[model samples]
Target: MSKFAKAGVAKKVMDEARKPQNQQKIKSAISNFTNKNKGGGTGAKPR
Candidate 1:
C-alpha cells in the first residue's frame, strides 16, 4: 500500500481502538502502523 493508505488505515484503526468492543490487538497495533510513513508524497515528484 502507499503512504496515503497507511495514514488512512492508521486513522481508522485508532478510531476503532478507542471503542471497547474492539480487541486489544487493535490497541497494540496502533503504535506499529501510525505515523510510520508520514511525508509530503501527496504532490508530484520533480523529474
Candidate 2:
C-alpha cells in the first residue's frame, strides 16, 4: 500500500488504542500471553 494509506491505517489504530476500554483489553491480552509463556526453556540439554 501507499504511504498515505498506511498513515490512515496507523491513525485509525492509534485512535482505537487510545480508548480506555481498548487499552484495558490490550493490557490483559499482553499479560495473558506472557503468563502462558513464562515456562519457556533453552535448547541445550543437561550435561
Candidate 3:
C-alpha cells in the first residue's frame, strides 16, 4: 500500500484507541498478559 493508505489506517486505529472503552480494554489485555508472564521460568529441569 501507499504511504497515504498507511497513514489513513494509522489514523483510524488511533481514533479507535482513543475511546474510553477501547482504552480500558487495551489496559486490561496488557495487564492480563503481564500477569500471565510474571515469574515465568525456563524449560530446564532442576538438577
Best by TM-score: 2
TM per candidate comes to: 0.42, 0.76, 0.74
The superposed Cα distance between candidate 1 and the true structure at residue 8, in angstroms, equals 0.4
Please give the lDDT score for candidate 3: 0.91
lDDT of 1 by residue, 3-41 (tens): 999999999978987887686676567766664545458
Q: After superposition, how far is residue 15 of candidate 3 from its true place, in Å?
A: 0.2
Instruction: Estimate, for each residue in 1-47, the C-alpha lDDT of model 3 and write its tens digit.
Output: 99999999999999999999999999999999888767568445669
Candidate no. 1 TM-score: 0.42
RMSD of 3: 4.0
Model 2 C-alpha lDDT per residue in residues 1-47, reported as the tens digit of each score: 99999999999999999999999999999999887767567445658
Comparing 1 with 2 on TM-score, the higher-scoring candidate is: 2
Among residues 3 or more apart in sequence or in different chains, the pairs in candidate 2 whose N, CA or C atoms overlap within 3 Å are none
TM-score for model 3?
0.74
